[model samples]
Target: MSAAIKRYGLGILAIAVTFIVFVVPLLFMALIAMKDRREANRLEFSWPTNFSLVENFQEVLSARKFMLVTAFINSTILTVVSVAILVILAAMVAWVLQRRRSRWNPTINFLILSGLIIPPAVIPTIWVLQGLGLFKTLTGLIFIEVAFGLSFCVLLFRAFISSIPKELDEAAVIDGCGPIRLFFRVVFPLLKSVIVTVIVVQSVSIFNTFQNPLYFLPGDSNATVQLTLFNFQSQFTTAYNLLFMNILLITIPPLFMYLFFNRQIVAGMTAGAVKG
Candidate 1:
């Protein structure tokens, strides 16, 4: 075969491999969600024998109406507030770090980078929050989400800000603009693309987080969506049909967000690499 034909053949093979590795498992989950408990347990690839999507969903939703509703509300509030704070705070800090040169800048950068490398001390965090009387509250969970997500968001924003022209800041300063005014008016507007990217990525991650909520905010009263998975599982056995339905419900919002914002994520990630 010609070189061009061989290259095209290899590309097709790679695509096929990727589909098998990623798409196939997602397809299986979708199929299982639509199947009966017996069929789901068998884990077959064949079409579902009995389609009871509505019934399964109703069972899961009716498990604990008040608790489920409250959990949904808590999750929404935590994810939205945390992501908003992360984007704004990280963007502002990154803008200054990129614009100003100082010995302290490297130290601050290193501290932020350390968050990604170190494992959180869960018990210590709980102890501190309890002492502050912030334990088992939705607001406290929001703070935890922000703490975990801040480092990565700052890194992303800093990389993007490095590509912005410092001359813009100089001109703004020349126009008698103060630092805060300059950032809010001039720099923040230019960060719209990266903000959208951060929102899409961090919003999904914070919404689906299981560990923090389970350990830090564990209780029926303060449960988030991820913690609600336990409602379908018991010590003896799990209700497979209802569990799958709950999984399906929880998966939809993030899946739709990704599908919608996929283009923006690609553009934001590539923006710095190309421009900087």
Candidate 2:
């Protein structure tokens, strides 16, 4: 009886902790977002007497002539292009690295793993981007995101690919399938779960990313969803209510995505462990 009671108590405690940690802050932000500027600037957790939800949203949306909407489009494009490159390239690289053993395999493996450990150098990256004539462009930002996200995607792909049966590879080869055909048809198709997981995870990260976009891809025209958050602030004054509203709007997409793909992310991550 005591053990069961203790387990239940612990579960309740965890629930309370989660609520305080995540829910409380989000609720507070929502409350503030719905308030007028004067009330929001007070930074109190109290309910607003004058709810300005519609007004705040309207101003935020139309601020600087619908820049937030433009940022959303840019963010979507960047996420799609970057994740596509990361998924295809990372899966292929992981497959090659895992299936083929060679004298330099260990060295290559170390370099790939090191990408996760070593932070990207912004100045040097910018220099290279400028040299390639991709600086301050969506193409450059896409490349930056892909490079930054590649290591983790490769690791996930390698882990999941290891669980796949080698017989499939052999059979495809015997059936006169070329490398590209075998991967696209046989191997890639089987990686749906992990690929979906990667897409969701990377999409959220890239969408919320601010630093890389600010440093490598600067400009009002190139502003991402994250950069729009900064637009509500300035040296002299800040639009707290509009800022919170903007945050709430920008945050909704990723939140909904996680909610939708929660199961797939869990399944994909754990699936790799089943066979390997």
Candidate 3:
């Protein structure tokens, strides 16, 4: 009984600490978003004297003439397309690498691993894109995001695929199944759990990505949600209330996604760690 009590106490303490560390900051940000410009400058912990969520949201929405909405749409498109491509390509490549053991497999693995270590050369990438007439385009940014995110996704998929028995593939092949059909019909369905995990994790990261879009696809016309934060900053001053509101707006979607998919993400991430 004493040991159980001690464990319960520790668990409660840990929960309290987590709430203080993570939840408190989110609550504070929400509070600031609810405050007026002057109250936000004051940055008090107390409840707002006057709730201005609608007002601040209107200002943020109206800023740059509804450019935030456009930016959100751009981010949604980039994140969805890039993550979908990453998952499909990574799963296929990892499946091939893991199932087919050959002399070249090690070399290919090494190259994929190199992506994790190598820092992308921004200028060279830009120059290459310009040479190909893809610079300053959404497609260019989408491709870049995919390339940047592929290594980690591949690693995850490869690890997950490794745990799946090779006999499944062999059996399918013996049944006269081609590689493409076998993968889609037999193997891909089994990967649903890990794929959901990758989708959730990558979607959130890509949606919040700031630097790639800023450098590769700058300007209001092609701005992403993260880049839209710049609209709140100016040469002379910054609108803290509106900025916080925008931050809050940008934060909610990813937060909701994680909350909704938390179980799938955890399961997928841990599935390989324990088995593979």
1 versus 2: better lDDT goes to:
2
lDDT of 1 at 235: 96
Instruction: Provide the lowest-lDDT 10-residue window in model 1.
Output: 267-276
Residue 259, candidate 2: alpha-carbon lDDT: 92
Which candidate number would show the highest lDDT if scored against the true structure? Answer: 2
lDDT tens readout by residue for model 3, 43-104: 77879999999999999998887999999899999999999899899999999888878999
RMSD of each: 1.7, 1.2, 1.8
lDDT of 2 by residue, 43-87 (tens): 899989998999999999999879999999999999999999999
C-alpha lDDT score of every prediction, in listed order = 0.87, 0.93, 0.91
**Clash pairs, model 2 backbone:** none
TM-scores for all candidates: the values are 0.93, 0.97, 0.94
The local lDDT score (0 to 100) that residue 76 gets in candidate 2 is 95
Single out the weakest 10-residue window by summed lDDT for candidate 3.
267-276
lDDT of 1: 0.87
Q: Which of the two candidates, 1 or 2, achieves a greater TM-score against the reference? A: 2
Task: Please give the RMSD of candidate 3 to the true structure.
Answer: 1.8
Q: For candidate 2, give the lDDT.
A: 0.93
Which candidate model has the greater TM-score, 2 or 3?
2
